[model samples]
Target: MWLYAGRRIVLTIPILLGVTIICFALVQIAPGDPIQNLLSPTATAQDAARLRAAYGLDQPLMVQYFIWLGKVCVGNLGMSISDNVPVAGEVLHAFVNTIVIALISVVLAFVVSMIFGVIAAYRTGSLADRLITAVAVFGISVPPFWLGVILVIFFAVDLSWLPATGMGASGSETFSYFRWADFKFAIMPIIALALPPLGIMTRTTRSSIAEILNQDFIQTLRAKGLSEAQVIVHAVVNIMPQAVAMLGLQLGYLIGGSVLVETVFTWPGTGYLLNKAVLTRDIPLLQGTILVLATAFVLINLVVDLAQSLIDPRLKRS
Candidate 1:
């Protein structure tokens, strides 16, 4: 397991580097010059030239990339052209916010999926099963932004059950675990972000449980007079490794999707921060945000791989 984990960890470096290269190239080669945008509208050609030199934009592309890469390695993400804030500070702060939102969303998704999945599998072709299936399908099909708007209109606008914008009450910067207002503010966005993954997980769990039930061992257990609950639990335990692996990957997707959901809901999360940075061409913040996200995804995949090996010994064998 250690060897496998080490291999996975080693592989993450190149994958992250590749992502950086592609993102950097796209940002650099894209049609707008950050320096040009920063200058006065009536500025002379020499003004543009000085701004270019100031930001080292006049250097060769490769040289510029190396300079940026060096800065990144040493923990300097560069300054935001728009705000002049340290890139690391802004990105790290946004990342911490994103993590809080992502964790809540994952917990909600897992709990909801497990309950519905077990019900659908146990009830099989009953009306309850059909309803669960339909709900899952709808959850999976709906775009998060659209869902966010509908939720805001119904829950926030009409009912006034929750706040429609921001992470918390207007001036509350630091979060509090015991605050009802903060929790209520987080719910709508978490629900919208979690829906698709919850749906997918429910379907996967239902199918996996059903398949396990058909196995000879399950039939033998039934013949031996095992209770249905006991049998189901045993089957779920056996297939849980695969389900866990699926959850890991899905969690990564959920985190990424939260960006869009947060944007639509006007929630203050890493996703929303990244979107704002991109619009304003905050290169340092953009690079930091994307790198952090990619790193998280890679780490999630690695953890899942290790978990699979632990759950199923055969996975670690030839």
Candidate 2:
């Protein structure tokens, strides 16, 4: 197991490097100058040129990239031209905010999906199963941004049950962790972001459980006079490898999806930070944020792979 883990960690280095290189190259290819955006309309051409030179934007693209890469290696992510803040500090703050929202959504999705999936599988062909499947289909089909807007309209505007947007009320020094106020504010955004994954997981679980139910061992269990509940628990345990694998992948997707979800909801998160960087062409902030997110994605996938091997001895042998 240690050997396998070490192998996975070693493999992640190239993946992260590839991501950094590709994102750096693509950002360079994007039109419009970050310096142009930073300069004031009243500034003369010479003034803009001087500013660009100071920021090293006047340098060759490759030179700028290597310079930035070297700085990143030495633990400096540069400063955000748009925000006038250290890139690392801004991204770290956003990272915390994004992870908090993503974690809640993942837990909510996992519990809801597992429960409904198990119930649907256990009650196959029943009205409850059909209804749950239908709901899952609808959830999967709905767009998160649209869903978020609709939720804001109904829950925040029409009903006035929650604040329309923003992380918290203005002029606040601290945050409310478990207040009704905060829950009302955050619940819709979390649900909107989680719905698709929840639906996907539900479907995956139901299919996995159904397959397990048809296995010869399940029949043997039934023939041995085991109750349906006993058979289901055994079948679920047997089918857990796939479920665990899916959970890991879905968790990654949920984290990635926060970018769009945060934007729609006006939530303060890494996704929103990235969006801000792109809009203003803040290269250092964008590059650093992408690196952090990509690193996280690679690590999560590695952990998931290890989990699958642990759950199934066949995987370990392979």
Candidate 3:
């Protein structure tokens, strides 16, 4: 197990390097000059040149990339052009906000999807199964950003049951999930983020469980006088690897794809930060945010791979 884990970790090095290249390349290819965005309308040509040189934007692409990469290696993500602050600090702050809600959303989706999927699988052609399938389909079909808007309209605007946007009056720094005031702000975004994953995982889980039930091993277990619940426990354990993989993929999706949902809700997260950076053409901020998010997605897959190997040692051989 340790050997397999070591190999996986070693393999991740190249993937991380590739991620950095993609992050840097994407930011560079994006239209508009960060220096132009930074300067005032009346700023002179020399002012533009000086500012560009200062940010090393005047450097050759390869040279700029190396400089940026070198700085990143030492935890310096450079300065945000629009905000005029350290990109690392800004990205870190937004990342924390994003991860907090993302983790909660994924966990909620995982648990609920598992329960719903198992029940639907067991019930098969029954009305309960149909109902659960309908819900899952709805979740899968709906876009999170649109759902977020509807939720905000219904729950926040009409019912006034929850706040529509922002982290809270106190902001992310003092935010606490345990506090209703702050928690209410998260409800819609979490729901928006959770639904698609919940649907996807539900389908995956139901199919996995159903397949396991049809296997000869399941029949053998049943013939051995195992209770239905115990048989289900065995089946669930057998499908855990697939479930973990799906969960990780869903989490990566939520982390990277929440831009729309965050924009709709005006939630203060990396998605929101990315949106702002793009609009302002803040290359440093954009690069830092993408790098962080991409790294997170890669790391999530690594952890998920490790988890699967642990659950099914046969995976290690593969």
Candidate 4:
């Protein structure tokens, strides 16, 4: 198991470097001059040249990439063009906000899916099963951005039960946990991010569990005079590794989907931050944010792989 984990860890180094290269390349080739943001309308040609030279924009692209890469290797992410602050610190702060929102969304999705999925499996073909299937289908089919808009219109506009936007009370800079207001602000975004994954997980879990029940082991256990509940408990335990694996994929979806959900709800997270960076064409900041997000997504899947190996020894062979 440790060997497998070590192998996975080693493999991730190249993948991360590849991601970094692609991120750097995309930013370099993007059409607009990043230095434009620094110039005033009244600035002279020398001012433009000076700013370009200062940023090393006059150098070869590969040289700039290697310089940036060197800084990244030494725990420096450089500075943001938008605010002139440390890019690493800003990205880390944004990551914290994103994790809080995304993790909660993931948990909610997992719980909701497992419960409904299990019920649908147990009730197979009943009215409850049909209703669950319908709702799960609807949840999966609806786009998060559209759903978020509808929810904002209904709850925030018409009902006024929840705030339409923002991470917390007005003018708040950081989120404080355990505060009802903060959680209150997150509710809609959470729901928007959670629904599609919840639906997919529910469908998959139901199908997987149902398939597991048909296996010879399940029949043997039943023949041994185990109660239905006992048989189900056994099935659930056997299915946990599958669930863990599926959760990892769903987590990736949550992170990707956050860009849309955060934008619709104006939640102050990395996704929102990325949107701002793009609009402002802040290349240094954009590269840093994407790199951090990609790293997080990769690390999460690594944990999932390790967890699956721990839960099911058979996976270690693969």
Winning model by TM-score: 3
State which candidate, 2 or 4, has the greater lDDT.
4
How many pairs of residues collide in model 1? Answer: 0
- Worst lDDT run of 10 residues, candidate 3, spans 30-39
Summarize candidate 1's per-residue lDDT along 1-318 as a digit string, tens digits: 788777878888898788778767877766766776687899999999988888888999899888988888888888878888987777777777777777777777777887888889888999989998998998889998899999999999999998897766543367664588677887888888888888888898888888888899998989999999889888888777878887887878876667788888777667887898779877667777777777788788878888888888887763
* TM-score comparison, 1 vs 3, better candidate: 3
Best-to-worst ranking by lDDT? 3, 4, 2, 1
Candidate 4, which segments miss by more than 4 Å at Cα?
Answer: 170-174
lDDT tens string, model 4, 40-119? 98989899999888877888988998998899888788788989999898888878878877888888888888888888
Off by over 4 Å in 1: 170-172
How do all models score by TM-score?
A: 0.93, 0.91, 0.98, 0.94
Model 4 Cα RMSD, Å? 1.7
The deviation in Å at residue 143 for candidate 2 is 0.9
What would the per-residue lDDT of candidate 2 be over residues 125-221, giving only the tens digit for each residue? 9999999999899889998888888988998889988787776763122445577766666788788888988889899888888888888999999
Residue 142, model 1: Cα distance from true site in angstroms: 1.4
Cα deviation of 259 in candidate 2 (Å)? 3.3
